[model samples]
Target: MLIYTGGTFGMVYDEDGSLAPFNFSLVIEKIPELQSLDLKLTVISFPDPVDSSNVDIEHWQAMAYIIKDHYEQYDAFVILHGTDTMAYTASALSFMFRGINKPIILTGAQIPIGATRSDARENLITALEIASTKNGKVPMLNEIAVYFNYYLLKGNRSQKIRSSNFAAFESENFPYLAESGVKIVFNESFMNTHDPQQKLEFYPKMDPNVVVLKIFPGITEEVVKSILNIKGLKGVVIESYGSGNIMSWRWMEELLRDAVSRGIFLYNVSQCMGGSVVQGRYETSKMLSDIGVISGHDITTEAALAKLMHLLGTERNVDIIKQKLNVSIRGELTVV
Candidate 1:
């Protein structure tokens, strides 16, 4: 089954020469080769296609419900999403579909299917093939993934690194689950596998009372205070400079402490693409750990934000939420 939420891959040139989303009813017609895959295909598309940038909590919930409703009928699922916010959606789905035993591959293209040099054909074709992979009636991959430019990456670990290149997404903290080469090579060792008997648990409650504050060299005291002290804020993901380093000012520490004291969840993640957040490894980051900030070890900011929202939405106890944030739930982080 394929779910379309609108993206460049779904667009075509209209009579006016402007790109518009093509009717999903003709999705298979656009690629007749899909018929040769020897599998029955079904597609579900949003009534109104949304630019990935405009995707929100409601959209995420809708998609989750669709999967939950039809999960029993489909062998696996593939989603066509916009590349702009595909990482965020993919991360959210990874957390939402916690124990799914079937592959849910999320894929998108840098160019439209109608374009002369489009990358859409290969992306969609390979994604469908991967989704159908099975080992004696059991799905080989049982997790959410972003398949782009011949690489299949863990959904939560992926980030879009380029806009123009076909190889736009990368999983920096982890290795590609499978590389699409002469033959799609599955790196079974690095791939996340799960028990097929585990009942899929849907975590649809995502609290959006979360914010990310990326630290800059000249970050101001007032700026920190304003964000940390924001009313009704449940969680904050601090994108601290390389290796989770922040200014070691007394006032800065005091404000962070205040947020924790107020029972607001706080997480420290690195702004760097590849390294883990070793919270106490430096004097600047030491106070963060000492003051109740949870270390998001090697977690992408996108995943950190999604995890925080998921934790805050489902767990009420401050202590339990803090513990879960530092722990790896669905391999989103490498807990130190």
Candidate 2:
């Protein structure tokens, strides 16, 4: 059965003009294509559907639990989620479920499912098909993914690149697992095969003691100092200028130096919408490299935040954390 969590794919415009999540179970009759699929589908939505922007680790945990609870009953699972945090959720689930044997396809739409030109029908139908497809005893897809704009991307590797386009998301530094067209041409070599012996487990705790500072023109050292001074700050993601450039101010250097000295995990990511963070390549960003800031490579802020939270919650080895942050644990980033 397909699980429809609250997201844009299931939202409807009310008579009063406000948009709200609808009960997807009630809309099965509206989509005639669903009947043709000949799959037994059931949807379970949150009583109050949340916007993807508001999605947090708690919601992620709940979603994981739901899937685990019904893991055996369903042939495969399709999650309808909000686009804003879909990649984050997908990334988190990649680590959360260690040995998922079934396809857990997460998908959403930019436009509402009810709209005449909405992309919801295609995305949802395709995701469901991908989830259910199998080779006798084996499922076609055995990992977490996001299906959007005719592409199935590794959930952790994707970032939303546009706000208005039907193709609103992209997986930076990674190729798509499959693209939908006249046929679903999958990159079979990239597909993950599960080990049946391993079990599904959920990591629910996420530390929120992280902060993201985006460096830009006129960003004062005082501002950096003030944020570093926040009590019990566990980690900071510095969104530096292109190629991870930052002001080499004496005060800024000292502030970062102090923060690192205090055992705060420092991460430097590029501020540009795309591209990887290249630490120590240029004079401007050399200070950051010397100050012991870990490079975040091409990870998006959304993925960075979620990854930091998960890392902080599970592990206490700072050196290991810093190393893993740069590495693509689930294809979320590319480490240079």
Candidate 3:
């Protein structure tokens, strides 16, 4: 099944020569190679496609519900998404569909499919190939993933690091699940393994009352206080300095402590692209740990925010949410 949620990958030139979303039902005409794959294809698109920047909880719920409703019918699923918030959606879906036994691949293009020099054709083709691949009678991939350029990255572990380059997404703290070249090479050791008896758990709810607070040098107390005090805020993903360190300012510590006291969950993730969060490795971050801030370990800021929203929406128990945050729920973070 191919789910189109609107992106550059589905765009083509209209009568006025303006870029517009083309009819995906006619995708076979655009890429006839799909016919050679010898697979039955079905396309479902959003009624009104929106840019990735505009994707919200409603869109996430729609995608999750669609997969859940069709879980028994499809062998695998492919999602065509915009590049901007692809990682966020991927991460959210990973958590929503825990213990999934089939592949759910998300791919998009940096350029429109209508352009002669576009990369959309290769991306979509490869994504479909990966989704359909199998190991004997079982699916080769059983988790949500992002296939871009030539690398297949675990959905929750991926981050969009480059805006203009073809290699836009990268898994800094994790290894690529597979790399496409002469042939797709699978890194089975790093791939997520699921229990055969584990049933898929669909979580349709995702609370958007979460905010990402990136710490910067010379940040003022007023700015920090206002963010932490946002009305109805349930969680905060703090993008801290090296090894999850923040300035050891008394005011900042008090603000964090007060936020914790007010039942706000603070999750600490490293600002660096390639490191884990060792909360107490330095004295600067020891205060955060002491204040009950959950360590995000090696999780990306995008994944951390998504996980926060998922937990806040599904679990009401604060302790359970904190426990899940410290562990890898869907391979989103590395414990060690």
Candidate 4:
């Protein structure tokens, strides 16, 4: 069975007026190719499927609970999600499920499945195949993944880079785990990260009070202070410039130091889309290290924010949370 949590892939223009949600239980009828897979498939969906832009922690919990409820009945699960927040959802789920051993493939299309030029058919079919693959008498994929265009990426490592292109998602810090072509070439190096003896545990509490603060050349001190001053803010992702460089003004340093002193978890991530945060690698970023800013090594802003929310909600100690942020919990980052 599959889960279609509304996104552009499931949307269709109705004769009544605007775009209304469709029933995903009849997915096989919409794309008859699914029936040809020789698999027992079903679908469970939210009452009012939402856009990725509107996705929040509550929706994430709803999705997780749905999977938990039907964990034993389905061989594997496939999610049709909006590309915008797909990576964030994937990252959150990686943390939500502690010991996963079943495929949870998240996929969507740049065009609607009903549209004449839609790319949804191929993506959904390939995703289902990958989700159902077995190896040596057991399931092949046992981790969260994102399948789109023709690439299969580790869920936590993927980010949506394009709004209109068919290849709308990319894994910036890591390579694709598998690319579906004539054969699904599993990047054996990045596949099947499960131990048969381990048991799966679910943690669905994700706090959403984190904020991303991007540093610019002339970012004012008052602006920085105001952001850090947000009441009940559990975490802040400081998007630093260049190789994690930031303005070295005294006011900026004091504000950050004060925030850290107040026990707010501060993470430093590179503003550049492709590189890791390299605190103390240059003179400009020395203050970041001095002020105890945790480096968000090679993690995209989307993943960074999702990870913070996951950790904040699940972990209690602030210092321990900071240390775990530097570790690659589920391949979301490369810790320095």
Model 3 deviation from the true structure expressed as Cα RMSD, one decimal place: 1.0
Residue-level lDDT tens digits of model 1 in 217-290: 87889999999888899899999988888999898889999999998888889889998889878899988989
Candidate 1: lDDT of 61?
Answer: 87
lDDT of 2 by residue, 34-96 (tens): 888888888777767788888877888888888888988887888889888888888877766
Q: Where does model 4 exceed 4 Å of error?
A: 16-19
By summed lDDT, the worst window of 10 consecutive residues in model 2 runs over 194-203
Candidate 3 C-alpha error for residue 118, in Å: 0.9
Per-residue lDDT of 76-145 in model 4, one digit per residue for the tens? 9999999889988998888888778889999998888777889999999999999888876677888999
Name the runs in model 3 displaced over 4 angstroms. Answer: none
Give TM-scores for every candidate, taking all chains together and pairing residue i with residue i: 0.98, 0.92, 0.98, 0.96
**Deviation (Å) of 198 in candidate 3:** 1.5
Q: Write the per-residue lDDT of candidate 3 for residues 80-178, one digit (tens) a residue.
A: 999999999999998888789999999999999999989988899888998898878888898999999999999999999998999999999899999
Task: Decide which is better by lDDT, 2 or 4.
Answer: 4
- Number of residue pairs clashing in candidate 2, backbone atoms closer than 3 angstroms, sequence gap of 3 or more or interchain: 0
TM-score of the candidate numbered 3?
0.98
> Cα deviation of 264 in candidate 3 (Å)?
0.6
Model 2 residue runs over 4 Å out of place are 13-20
Clashing pairs in 4: 1-42
Q: What is the C-alpha RMSD of each candidate to the true structure, in Å?
A: 1.0, 2.1, 1.0, 1.4
